[model samples]
Target: MKTVLFPVLISSALVLTACGGDDSPSKAPAPEVISQPTVAVKVAAAEPVSALERGEQIYKRCKACHTVNEGGRNRVGPNLWDIVGRDAAAVEDFAYSQAMEESGVVWTEENLSTYLLKPSAFVPGGRMAFAGLRDEYDRDAVIAYLKAQSPAAQ
Candidate 1:
């Protein structure tokens, strides 16, 4: 009985030793690699037109109050013929406000745009009844036209 019991115990101990213990380390799977599609992009360029061309289109609204040719007479407002470099309120026959005469503002592109945008804002006491052009593109075109009308640009 002891001989049989000893052999059975030895076999069980050998089987347990062959099986690895829980202390052994485990391994993880390798990471996967993915690829993305490439895209192409393009940009457009900006093209600016001459001031006269823009101004001519803008002056359609101004035709009711002003004229821009030789022998052109004053209508509701004084004739704007060759008025780019001219002094403000300098028209001889037409009456001008004292504020306009005293304002001492030069009719440059900057000044014209500001005055055309808002006359009362530019000169609080100004008599020009027409509200200014709200669109910036229209303003630029009108200024370009006025600049073109000037002898200097030609």
Candidate 2:
């Protein structure tokens, strides 16, 4: 019993010493980090489109009704050639609402801006079917586009 017990005790101690020692396997070394160049990136700023160009895009919707070319005939809406600075509802053959014709408003940029924002609001009981350009930028663009076509622009 002593011989067997001695060997068993020795074996247990050896196992414990091996496993519990500070000589355990180490973790893998961290990868070497290299410094990179500090690059100063040049960011190009976006340039705004010319008002006339932007207005041209906005005018695509208005093309269905208004024409900006000189001598152009009225369609669903009146011919808009030289409309800027012209009197409102002054297209000769085109029928204008009493409300608009009697509004006594000129087609100045300021008036046009207000009118384009909400046509009906600008002239109550007017016959224009457009809901109006809601965006201030869009209204400006349309005005710019109209100005570009008008003799006043040149």
Candidate 2, which segments miss by more than 4 Å at Cα? 1-47
Candidate 1 per-residue lDDT over residues 1-154, each given as its tens digit: 9999999999998877666445776343455767677776776766666666667877988899888775689998887777776788878988888889899988877888889999999988989998889988788888777766655765
- Number of backbone collisions per candidate: 7, 0
> Please, what is the whole-model Cα lDDT of each candidate in the order they appear?
0.81, 0.88
lDDT top scorer = 2
Query: What are the candidates' C-alpha RMSDs?
Result: 13.2, 9.9
Global Cα lDDT for candidate 1? 0.81
Model 2 agreement with the true structure over 100-142: per-residue lDDT tens digits: 8899999999999999988889999998888988899889988
